[model samples]
Target: MVWFLQAAAAPALMALAAGAAISALAIRLCAAPVETAASAAAVLVGTDEHELDADDPGNLGGPHLRSARMVRHGAALSADLVALSTAGAAVGLLLGVPVLAAEGIITVLLALGVAMLAAAAAAVVPHRGRPGLERAALQLGGIIPAVLGGAAAVAAAALWIPSRYKDLRFEDVGLENFTDPAITGGTPTPRTELEPMIEQALTDMGQWVSQTDESQYASAFLDVLTLYSVTPNVVVAIALGLGVLSALALAQLLGGAGHRFGGSVLRAARTSRTGGALGITAGLGSTALLAAGGIALLVLVTAVLNVLAAGVPSLALALLAHAGLGALIVAAACAGPLLAPVLADRPEAAVGLRNAAAAAATGPRGVMLLSGLLTALAALGPVVSALQLAPRAATIWEDRSLHALTPSALPLLGGIALGVLTVLLVTSAVLDGARRLGANAVVETRASLLEGRGRAELGELAEMVRRAAAPALVVAVLAPIVAGFGLGPAALPGLMIGVALTAAGLGLWMIGAASTLENAAAVIGSGRYGGRGSWGHSGALGGAVLTGTLRAAIGAVALPLLLTTSLVSALAVSAVVGLSTDGTSHFLRWGVAALAIIVALTCWVIAATAPEVDLEDGEAELSTPLFARADDAPADTLAAMDWEVGDEDVERTPARARGKRRRGAADDDGRAPEDAKD
Candidate 1:
């Protein structure tokens, strides 16, 4: 009850905080971190600081005492997307260039330059090619996975296309309808209305799903890959462009979800075992709820979309399609936790799980927006080919999609994404804010009073609770790996989800405790430096500005990559998946994908070396800037105060709390110390 009461104070503070009243706009934009901070504070107020010791993990530092910048946390995270793209782009070009060479469209100079770029992208993983040629060779092995998958996709396409898409020849379809009438007589009548056409297509699709073997889905996917790949240099160009766009979506995922995950896991480690366990349980429940709620939210908005779709059917169709994809992502994310047992002990489960998240995040909104712009240009190749070149015996398969699922749907989704974006900007912003608020209030208030302690026990209790949670963390991580070993090749996709959930769950457990600490410190800090004339407030504001700008700068980098690498993996992965027929080669195909993910991530890790700095100030330089200096950090990672504070400001904070903040704080270096007594 008290927790909710404290959480209720957040909006009031937002409204009452000195300059907070100045802008609702600012509140909306920055609500994510602010809400997170506030929620963290309320938990501490309700906490029992007993049954723990200083050696506990939750005693580790949090972002609260020193202001955490959204930028410093996730600035370089987009490197993951870039790495995927270059590896993919290399594979695509290597596979496609030969076709061009056969056609005599390729030049020596062009091939060399393309090769160099790909090599460089591959080499830059983790950092300088320090992993040596052997590692590079391993990364080069990444191409094997995609190639293996692509070959399988092609084989799959061959068997399925003729059986099902054998006859897509419509009288009114293609360049034949748009060409000069003199050659093909007058325009045909009885044109189909798009709504009915789409309806019929969807109806057929439903029927297909009900009756067809599941393997046909991959066969169906391969159909799209064929068109893109047959285009010579165009495929490479298109892939590079998509890879660029994918970087943005990836960055956001790492910053938003990954950051959340990392923080949660770290905090869980810092909390009491029982509290962490309960926190984990609650988090899983929330994840399920959020996913369900997101779908329900989308479903509710669908009526509004329906009205719009009635007026502009194409636009609505795209939104509807993107909505379906979004629903799937949410479903997958939520369900993955339930399936965590399947992911344990995989060779590179973490890498695969991260892939799933990145794939989901980029596919719906990001892909739709970027690909929509290129729709006109993308259409030109097919239009020109269909009109100029005489249709080959097998050309219909190349030029046209089997059904409504192909080009039109992708472009429509993209268009809809762009169109509805501005309107939904506020929607997303409000959502982030609301989520932040709801998460803290519920968790903290309910779990605040686990066990009570004495007046003299204030500081001791907080430390105890934090440490208690530490030991249980090992079980959380290892359980999945152990469970996963009992599984097989089929676990590939599930592994991705499980990894995601494990990360989410671990992080989820820490939320209440971390939030309690950070929010409390923030509250105390706010009051201490609440004055408009205070240096602390001014410093915080400056840090906020710097971080906001830095984040924007990172976004700027992603914008161009959005153009190139967004499709890089899609092209590469699809091409690979298309090579194998569905089901028959399921193990082989997914195994290839797993290998690719492992190879790419492995190269990035093993090849990249982090050099330690012996200098004292190096810790500060290495640490996230704009955050509080280690010297100023509270005894507890989140704050110096116990659950209780006094009427006198000085009494609330213990001088002993600042005596030692680990060797890292005292000596300014955690990574390098002779005695290594942290």
Candidate 2:
């Protein structure tokens, strides 16, 4: 490990330098356009001269003003980085394809060009000051693992290629025999002779294929499909999913370290450290627990599904499996966001969870469809890349065996490209999930405080529905049609099963993980645990860590059992009817049944538990009045009287009005001026 670290250091340092430079450049470029617009607006408004310099103390906005700008710029830069990285990775993979057709110095130059373009594109995204650049740099760090992982994958694939092609022999096609004669006779073979020999070899191969048995061809095709399409896709999905979790873990660690550093800096700066230490401890503990719990839950759920599918052969069981799985998915999704509030030391988090469930139950179709669509989009890149590899590898092997000395690098390069793209997609999804959950939690908490009720707000529910509606509709309507055409009836059942499991499992896992981090952060920021050395803080931290470990243990045991059950069930079913149309229909029926069961269970749960509003503790008093107006005077104050006065009564009217005003003012004040003075 030491040696590996040492070896990696050089590239790491180089990448760090490059990243810093790119960030600096990007910030300058991004700021220019925005700054220009700001200047133009200032001029248009005739405030150009009066405009406050960002560094001027008289500006009054303080450091927070610049910080807010940096955040906005950072977000924009982050989005641009996503797009740029995908494009660069794709370009690199595409460029590698030409390397197979022509291997030369130009190809190497082109690769260099691709790298340069990626870096340049990254630098082109607008950012603000040094802080904005630093943020961009941090985001850029995420792309490294993706790029390195892709390269490593490609290298591994390259090594594996020869084994797959080892059985093929050129002599069997009569090309080697024809070419060997001229060399054996000590005579140079003419270009014409070689060309004819290659043509004849191709013709003979075509003839052989035409004469091959249909059953043999069909079997071969099926073997290829299973090997290339089904198996690789499953493996890729699992591997990438694990990679995402690992990345999130690393990010959490980095964030914790940064938080600690920031706290130390604050302490050094003479800021109040009271409760800071305790907050950090509790936060760390909660974060660990959440991460562990989420991972364990995912593993356990996956294992159970796998076991049941594999172990149970009963058609009824297979049909019913989806309902159980769907229910779990719903439970996880609703419960996950509430974990945020839970970590915040709020007992009301439970109420939030109940409300979330109610919201989900009210719109199960939208939630499931949206979750499914997002899952599909996330997995699509990796799956397609996996499927493409088999055919690409086959083609490369055939071509290289006939003419080249080495395997083509295209497949592995493509894998690297796709892997990077997958990482970006997953990362973006995770970030988006966190943002949405955090926002939802804020909205729910505020609603509870103002309304004295913990019910889901209409705006929040509507936003959820709106965001999910289109995607859900597309996936619901299009997925089955695409499956029918692409996978065929026999394979469709397995595909559907896999999709359902993956979509539900992955969606829940992402939500849980994201929410956990958000909630933990909120707890720490809330400063409820006391200072650094406080017992409450330490205890919270310890509890969080313990929770995570326990969850992990549970998952470890649960997953294996589930996997065993699935495998056994699947084998039993196959033994009875095999993978036929009837078997497929049985699985489909089970899935539908599962959906129904889940919907019913969710509805029941929601109906049984209502959101309990806390009307006491001043919440009811804080509730906004139905007829409240922003411009209204104090409720105790009487309205001013408007009167018309004739000349004779003018003098008397002024005195009377002044006396009445004094009396009303005293009444509104709830005290007489003379009594207040005494």
Candidate 3:
């Protein structure tokens, strides 16, 4: 009772400490800004300038001094000071209090809303120009994350508090001890402290029981790998690393293309087939290096895994299995590009499809499968090996060290992690190359498809769809490889869930991207507000597709795994409880099931969402400010704008565009055109 009371009170104490610290920090930070603003306002109000009645513009040659501006400015500054202080107080209180309490999520959400509104109010600060709005925007962006972090902390505290109960009251539960019959017997066991009646009951009930295999290490391992079956922490780490890698690869590849191809490629692709062809060729040539890098990456991972697997006795087969699996993944990744163009309707959609296809083809499918398999096998290997060695060894456990079981598993996990990173780098490269090629190809094909009307376009679209669908399908096919290596004989079903989610998500994105882009031009040509709506529609579509993909993937994996694991665990527990079993049985029957369900659901959600977000939507429009604004210009206005720009283009036309090509145009400096000019 006392322990429970202490446990419950712990969260309150922690909350108080956090709240107090936040309050102090907020108040301290607010002091300087508040004081400075107040002093400035007081000076302005009391000065001779205020008595001069700037409200009379005639005083400066007009009627009213810009008193309206002055009042607005003063009010804006005052509002900023007030908002800053209020936000600070809220943050401090939120932090100081235990956010994990029942009210925490709501409290944090409320605080977020208040803080954002306050930030907006602060933006009215009197300024001479639009730059003040920009300043406010920057501050708003920075503060939102801080608010989110505080909320996450609260949620985390809540998650942790309840979990602490298991730690405080629970004892270490072991598999071996639970299986031993004599130790659980009614009489006191001579070998250990286990009550004998319980041991006898288990024995009579035909359950094996033992008291060994109690290494804290195994528990930690289980906590790490098995806790969240999908989107485990390891997977999230890998996904984040991959996302970053993809972004970098994209930047580098595009930057290089821009440097080599020149700006005309964009207009050329739009106007002339010859230009489109040349641009596409140039893009492909540039992107080849990146794809080659990916190929090398896959090969390296395969070689490394083979080498390491060879080092272990029984693990060699597992390594071979992983290699075969990797071969399939690599094949699919390499092949996906070839298929993407066939599946797409628009050029850009095709490019995106190809990019996703490449990522799907090349990503951590093999490594994930192999790692999961190895982790499972590693877990079971010990028990199975121990049981097999039980009769032969001096002591069943003396010779059946967990070390024997862990060798295959530990390296598998490590190798998978390393392999995942390698795959990410290469996959990113493949995607970058695929996008470059696809973009160029798309520009070329879009006209062809549009000109041909239905038949040829439909054929092309079907082909592109097939291409886009291929990589994800291949990934799905290869998931069984993981199932084969994994521990539970039925583990294949779980692996399938994850694989299906990934494939379905990829497919959905491909379809959505295609459908959305087909309408981009029509939507953007409407009007300024229409353009905003178009862009918003595009963005929303992209977001929804990505979100749906992630959610589906996560749900597919999590729902089934949770339902299966929990139900199975419940059944196991009920059986033991019905038999009136020992402490081991009690823990298994009750405790493990809940943990399994929680872990499963968590894994599903995390695994599904992180990897395949809307990078293009986030990055592309933002990069080209004009493109971002393009949708806002009405068709007539855009035509007029183009005519005006075209006149300038004609006046400043480069001699090269008129076929006045200069032989050996390259500068003696040997740098690319842009750099050479510099």
Candidate 4:
């Protein structure tokens, strides 16, 4: 519940996210043919179509070819994102917006993770593999960029071309001298997208010395940051990142099938391929890591772990939503690389492996588009509000919005809710089982490429696949449970209408449960209580909460109890218990909201006072001089004197001399020069 509250978390989150995002991108792009062929024999072409060894995992050639192919896709997604973030970082120097620098990197990666989870969820419902709504989404996505770019280009040309030619003569045109605004510092800039982010990052880094706290490296760190911000490192790195990402995205999406050289790899046998299964495994790994991050972020922001205690199911649902979106964006980018593979080596097709590898994203240039879409859809406003697209997006950020959602407090009788949630979890599992029923059902008649592999090897391979897919699958399914607790009540009803997802549950169940058990054991095994003061009050509160939690757990698993009474009757008892306890005394004094505010303020104050940020001021000076004259600026340049300077030179404001009037002994008026001047 309190992870994002820490400073300096953005970069680490992004680094891991980028690594994970590319895994899916690699599989979707370069090794998709193997995946498709493994799924259904009909997807292959010519000789390869009939040669399909559906379960082999060897059809994409071998480990070498598969891996080699994935390199392009992996590089495209990672490098592009890095470049974009770097550019944002650099541009942030100008606008004082630090978050912009890395915002694309984190949000986009998470968004892709989210998208994939969505696809997994959709898989829950049965479908023929025909394009439906996605076709429109693709068309809309494709058209918007083209139209916007064309419109912008035309406007720029119309505004600039006539003016250039208006003053043109053949002689003048040939010898044009350009004015450099760089020297004069009149350069305009984008909005302050990066300032706050960078400042926050800087503050977090320098926080040790901000208050009474001390660290030996604190001063040194500030000095290094000063050097970094003051120099062109930020600018150079950012510009390089932006330009490179832009070029790569364009080249990959627009690259021709024919090589710059006349030669091609199209006729190369599929045996030349490399390890394709690894990409899927990588995709799985990346998905899980991303889910963890998304879950952590939500837990911190939503106060799920607050003393008030939110509906646990709600937290689970939100995390899943994030995972689903992130997966989808990543999946879309993967489409470019995978499309040709899906086509296979058909006679009519000339597409090759190399052509599919260089693909990457989703907005301004497809950054976080899914998040925007989700927020727009989930906003608790009217249809008229939806239609008014650009009318003050403040509503989109309101507390009511999912982006700012505050989970409903966990009811005292929430044990029944857990049981209900468990039932929903069972249902989601059933749906997912149905989803896997038809995936790649046709195994080829040929001896399995993996036939000689031992039982252990097959089991290991199956385990890898399962582990890889588990994060996304688990998130998707658990998210359905949250929906039952009244999260998102959109189109789907009686199933997945809302989400109550919390990634904390997954980690706790999978990883933290053992430690939790260990703690309980140690507590139970202790000879006697010694830490508490003379009075037992200190431990008593935690004890009550712990024992109460145990009771609730017992109630949750007691199916006979549920059977003995109707659901309504059971619910009534739970409600009675909750109402009875609602007004009773408890440990909370300031409450969770107050604590959250205090923590936020402390973090902000810490960041606001961070050292080594003065270097940014210097960088600003180098980028743009205030663009207005300061009172103390040097008087006008001597070289470009006005034609009417004789009159203009007469002090315009005589009462306020440019220089302080001199009063000294050197003045000779008559008697004693010093006395006369005085």
**Which 10 consecutive residues of model 4 have the lowest summed lDDT?**
262-271
For candidate 1, write residues 576-643 as lDDT tens digits: 22332132343554465455445434432332232221223345443322122324653565565575
What Cα-based lDDT does every candidate model obtain?
A: 0.27, 0.30, 0.28, 0.27
Which stretches in model 1 have alpha-carbon errors above 4 Å? 1-291, 302-317, 320-569, 577-678
Task: Point to the candidate with the largest lDDT.
Answer: 2
| Alpha carbon lDDT at 261, candidate 2 | 24
TM of each candidate vs. truth: 0.25, 0.26, 0.25, 0.23
Off by over 4 Å in 2: 1-133, 144-146, 167-608, 614-678
Q: What residue runs in model 3 are displaced by over 4 Å at the alpha carbon?
A: 1-152, 155-459, 480-483, 486-678
State the lDDT of candidate 3 residue by residue for 1-678, as single tens digits: 112332233234323322332332222222222222222222122111122121232122111112222322244323322332222223222221221122222222333343354334334422111332422332233223323333333333334333321122112111112222322333333323333443444343322113324343333222222211221122212221222233223223222222212232222222222332332333334334433443343344435533543232223222222222212222122222212223332235433232232212112222222222221221222223222222222333322221223435442233233323322322232232223223323232233333443211112322332233233222222222222222221232233323323322332232222222212212222222133233333332233222222222221122121112212221222222222222233334334434544443443344233222122544543433312332454356654563344666656878776333122333454555556435
Off by over 4 Å in 4: 1-283, 286-348, 351-408, 411-436, 439-678
**What is the RMSD, in Å, between candidate 4 and the native fold over all Cα?**
35.8
Q: What's model 1's TM-score? A: 0.25
1 against 4, candidate with superior TM-score: 1
Candidate 4 structure quality by residue, lDDT tens digits, 157-192: 234222221122212212122222321133432223
